[model samples]
Target: MKPGTLHLIPSPIGSNTDVLAPYIRSILESVPYIIAENEKTVRRFLATQMSSELLAAKQFAILDEHTPFQDMPALLDPILAGQDGAIISEAGLPCVADPGSALVQLAHSHHIPVMPHPGPSAIFQTLMASGLNGQRFMFEGYLPIQEQERLARLRFLESLSSREQMSILWIETPYRVKSLFASLCRALREDTSLTIGQALMTEESFIYTATVGDWKKGAIELKKSPAVFAIQALPVAAGLRSNKSGGKAVGKPKK
Candidate 1:
């Protein structure tokens, strides 16, 4: 029997489901089996897109951080046996910042085709609205939680960004958002550009970019919510000019 294909499906990062295109729904309906980060969340999302009867008939397997490496191959057994299957995350694209990359790699070794569908991703969306350098940027995912260690990492990223003129992106848990923002304000240079994207793609979404000095002037009260942060340090020449001018460097205005 011909090996079935594996679909890499993306889930909504926020309350907005309009990003779920019609084609994605069709693909979800076609697959008989699914591997997801959270079974309950996936089922709830599927229920919004398809009939309850159809959702009820689908088989699911768990694939999160705790899933053992040795057991991943078996998750693809149904697909290897000629049954179409998919991998979905609790939010955003699978295998990006989320889990399931290993299984996708195993599928390729077995000669199974992998197809990725488009959907909302907090990383990309944050970058898009950041007003920062889109041509060159890196997603650092999450930063170190330790206060001293995190400060070191922030300075390193700031230096790297200044040297390369690239944007550095990372996320923080909702509860840690305020603390991370506070750290960014303290550790980064005054003229460094900082962006905060909170609750992106939803009705309550907030995105703003400003210089570190400006952020310190009028601090915003950040609630405990999903957030992505990015920074773009001044280029070497710009840094020197700003320093000579008493730290008043023009940056992309807050948006």
Candidate 2:
């Protein structure tokens, strides 16, 4: 039998897979073994696209942070044996910011075919709704948790965004969302365009983009919600004018 492919499946970020492509569903149906960040989550996702019988028959291997690195090599045994296998995350694409990237790297080192299926990503979804500089943006993932270091990091990212005319995107743990927002409000200039997307792709989702001054007028309580924050780069003069007139700062032109 030919060497089986290692499919990098993109699971839904939210509770439902309504945003996933039809082909992604078909790919999941074809794979019998899945290397998941969390077996329960992957199983739940599979249940949505498959029959209960097929779901029960599917084999799973967990690959979260707690999993030992040395054990990763063994996870690919099924794929190496010519059995098509998949790598999935609790939400979104397995490795963009998840642990599944390690497996993908291993697959490449072994000359195994790796396939990526397009699906919904909270990062992209947040950018889409953020109305920021989507054409020239960087995903910084999570920021420093230490107060002083985090403040310094935020300043650096803000300055980088301003200088490069690029949007700086980052995330924080659910419980720390409010604190991060507060830090952003404190550290960023009044003119900088700040955006926050909460519970994206869901009914309770909220996305708002405005100047830092605007955000301060009446900041929404983030509570313990999953959120993504972005800062749009703007020219100094334009940003000043927007701050004065209560208007949006001009974002970088998509060229």
Candidate 3:
């Protein structure tokens, strides 16, 4: 049996082809089959760009959270039997916040080889630029999208940022970004600094690092650029605000 390989291709966040050129060509020439989150978007992007290399008479299958579990046995059987395939997420790196965990677990259970091709990922990009503490950080992924769940998660993240002294990373739906930032303004330690990165490594990008108090006073307008954010943990200063209040801390740290 031929040894099969599973490649994780990390597509760009926004529409940028040049950044992904080398990887695209490699996949088209090498892999016989491809799995993707949105087959239509991939087709549309190839068509719009008039790229014959990646989408020229190529066949693809849609894969997502709803991908039937029963089909895994048959689908992955070929790979175990040894036919190489590539998996592409909607954006960023696969298996991060993306829904490739189950497929990966399947591969592991059967001892199939899974290889990754490193590329741009929003989570790491934000961390690199956020000026937050990358040494000890937590990637919280997307908080609950619904109001109650979102707030609950936000409250927990807020406490972690203040008390734990760790960088908190998060992403929200583009449209809800303004409101999410507003809530953070109401739920974080004062003097606690946050770095917000929007569209990292792409056109129309922006990054801001500032305190929660400055944010509440309209110092920064989040509406202009929606983004992934990192709130760096602060030192245990002398004037610590009540963890529940999440307001500004009033003084410097004790020596």
Best by TM-score: 1
Summed backbone clashes in each candidate are 0, 0, 1
lDDT of each: 0.89, 0.81, 0.70
Per-residue CA lDDT of model 3 for 72-186, tens digit only, reads: 6566765666778778778888888887878888887877789888777888888887677788899887767666677677667766775777788987667878877767766
lDDT of 2 by residue, 5-105 (tens): 99888887678678888877777888889888888777888889988888888888889978887898899888888999988877777788788777788
In model 2, the clashing pairs are: none
List the candidates' TM-scores in order: 0.95, 0.90, 0.83
Q: What is the C-alpha RMSD of each candidate to the true structure, in Å?
A: 1.7, 4.1, 5.0
Off by over 4 Å in 2: 236-255
| True-vs-predicted CA distance for residue 19, candidate 2, Å | 2.1
- For model 1, residues 56-146, the per-residue Cα lDDT tens digits are 8999999999999999989989999999999998999899889989999999999999998888888898899888999999989899999
Off by over 4 Å in 1: 249-255
